[model samples]
Target: MTANRVLYLLGSAAPPVLNIAGVIERAQAADWDVCLGLTPTAARWLDDELPALEELTGHPVRSQYKLPREPDVWPPADVAVVAPATFNTINQWALGITDKFVVGFVAEAIGKGIPIVTMPCVNAAYVRHTQFDASIATLRVMGVHVLYGDGGFVPNEPGQGRPNGYPWHLALDAATSALTRRDAGRE
Candidate 1:
């Protein structure tokens, strides 16, 4: 991977979003030019850090749709990683509900054939809801690399969530692998 590779690291309002700065640094170290996008709530959560985050990525951290007249803000994404995807975000994405900027971009990325990797941060109780599993299945059917179950996110109990333990690496690895496979296909 070269520094020219652009990574769209889209985040939802999960506890792990707090660790985004560190994750961005890791991605940069791995040779990706990262662009950060956040859900509205996640943006608020990191409001105090937005300027620093933009300075770090060298791109604006966007949380809403740009005006139609506005030029594109960042380079095109070679891959996208949706980490700490929350229960609401997952369902909305699977159902084609593009109300939020993060979900909208990812949902469209599917049709654009942009490789996507996502790791849910929901709890065991939330997974028990019928819609949760169904949504995950739907995303997989639509070509999103959902990092759940055995090798990926295993839901913890609701009140007992571990923010620091979220596997950021899994989503990052999957994203880079997608880019690798894509590059291979070009040969």
Candidate 2:
């Protein structure tokens, strides 16, 4: 199969945000042309590394919506992974809320039949929110591969996330598997 264009959608959770370089390296090694879209707060968190990340991906890291007449700079995504998907982002995305650029792209990707794999990086405390479980269920019903709980992203205790334990590879693996499944169906 040809190399897939992967969009790495990042939210404002600390673990994956801090270790984004590993995510990029693994994706590139897997023959993916990766681009990044950061939620606004995530952009702020990774401000200093933005230039390096852009250089690594060879595409601008988008954090805001482009103007109506402006052409999109990044390649059209064949698959997307929303790693470090926060509680807020998950809920907003499921609800079709497009207040942020990342959420807007994800919502549109759903309609366009683009395969999306998401690994939520929320704490146990936040995971207990009533809307959180419902939102995840809704996204799953929409055909999104949500990596949470067993065999996926287990919820970390409040303030207990270890950067080393964040499952960036799992998200990438899921994205590749989803793409493979999608292509097989076509054949």
Q: What is every candidate's alpha-carbon RMSD to the true fold? A: 1.2, 1.8
Clashing pairs in 1: none
Tens-digit per-residue lDDT, 1-187, candidate 2: 3456665555555567888877888788888888888899999989999999999888899899999999989888888888889899999999999999989888999999999999888889998889999999999999999999887999878988876888787888898899899989999
TM-score for each model: 0.98, 0.95
- The candidate scoring highest on lDDT is 1
The per-model lDDT (C-alpha) reads: 0.95, 0.86
- Per-candidate total of colliding backbone pairs: 0, 0
Estimate, for each residue in 12-32, the C-alpha lDDT of model 1 and write its tens digit. Answer: 999999999999999999999
